[model samples]
Target: IRAVGTGQDALGEVTIRVREGSRIVQGKGLSTDVIEASARAYVDVLNRLASGHARSSADSAERELAQGGVARP
Candidate 1:
């Protein structure tokens, strides 16, 4: 978790990354509550990974995101 910025209404931003086979998956979440933001980020990563295939090039991870890797509010 990291600070969003000074004077910002949000509490913090959370970033989560996971390595599946040869690819890397990333997720981010921002919220006024730190714990909630972390959970959001964690869930985001899990969802992305679940919707993705394990076999691919490193750059394919970016492609997956571009193609709309599972997202949630």
Candidate 2:
């Protein structure tokens, strides 16, 4: 995770990266409010993680099976 603030009003830019197995997911946020930017960046990554969008479908299916869940056909 990396965050930077600039300008007089303190515009914020945040970058969040997450790694799962061989996959790497990145999220970015920019806002005048630093806290809002941070939350947006974090939530962006969380949404991807929750949706399994960072991993390949095949990988996700394999993981599901390993966890005793039904695999997608």
All candidates: TM-score: 0.61, 0.53
Judged by whole-model lDDT over C-alpha atoms, candidate 2 comes out at: 0.73
For model 1, the superposed segments whose C-alpha errors exceed 4 Å read 53-57, 60-73
In model 1, the Cα lDDT at residue 1 comes to 88
Pick by TM-score: which candidate is best? 1
The per-model lDDT (C-alpha) reads: 0.73, 0.73
Instruction: Show the colliding residue pairs in model 2.
Output: none
**How does candidate 1 fare on TM-score?**
0.61
